[model samples]
Target: MIRMFIRDEAGFVVSAELVLIATILILGLIVGLSSIQHAIVSELNDIGVATGNSNQSYWYTGFSSEKDFANGGFSAYTRGSAGNDTQDDCDNDQCDISCDVPVNEGPKSL
Candidate 1:
């Protein structure tokens, strides 16, 4: 006579610890990249400000004559003057020795 034996099969196991570790690593990488992007943007903003001042200074020095001032830099520093004329076709609004132009089209010439 022969006896039959039954065997139990083992199922696959999923480790929660490994999943948590992977998630933390991904979050850290995302945070690091975000910080890097923020720093780059900040530096670019600073650069833009510096270059803007330099351009404005050039306009002031080169086009500060009475005639150019009357015609608003003769189309050179047209938008970099102390007035509020929107026909100058310039990017930077009118600026003077005291304050900058308001975003809402107000004048504060110094």
Candidate 2:
């Protein structure tokens, strides 16, 4: 039985074909995933830009009123202000996929 199995080549071709097909599928999957990652990063960058561009500043005028009633007087006051400047740290910059490391020279002798 061992000798017969060793000489058996019936499934050899099928195994080789499976390996080739699996390799191709894995390569394709890697390429597809890389593309998806890029697309998602770009979209997120766009969203960040949009959010940064939006201004949340607001202002409302203040009011003061005084009413006198038979015995006492009532007074009301309100203050308004504006804030929230549109300052985006990204500055509408797109997402960079590459690593940008600064090269340092070797240590200098004292």
Candidate 3:
């Protein structure tokens, strides 16, 4: 008489199949997450480029929107007045000043 043996009849094959499916699922999840990360990075890079272009255009053309022009003027005046008033007050008793300072009064024209 001859005896026949059953292959993976103890649920081992089923468990191996489950493990393989789980591994594939995990790998898919990893790839999905990486794609999402890449998309976010790409979007951020695009936004950065757009903002840089806007700033460059503003500076290059010496053209600013109303809000930007107002803010720039305020900042320029504030910066010009910042140390001068304090120095003048310390040097003398009164805050004597002049408005002859031109906007963008630097070595290079902007």
Which candidate ranks first by TM-score, i.e. highest? 2
Candidate 3 lDDT tens digits, 43-99? 966675555444222112233334466445432221111211222222322333347
**Which pairs of residues collide in model 1?**
none
lDDT of each: 0.58, 0.79, 0.54
lDDT of residue 2 for candidate 3: 31
Q: Give the TM-score (vs. native) of candidate 2.
A: 0.63
Q: Model 1 has how many clashing residue pairs?
A: 0
Per-residue C-alpha lDDT of model 2 across residues 26-72, encoded as one tens digit per residue: 99999999999999988988887788677778777887676876756
Weakest 10 consecutive residues of candidate 1 by summed lDDT: 56-65
- TM-score ranking of the models: 2, 1, 3
Off by over 4 Å in 1: 1-14, 56-110
Q: Candidate 3 overall Cα lDDT vs. reference?
A: 0.54
Clashes of each: 0, 0, 0
RMSD of each: 17.2, 5.1, 25.0
Total colliding residue pairs, candidate 3: 0
List ranges where model 3 is wrong by over 4 Å: 1-14, 56-110
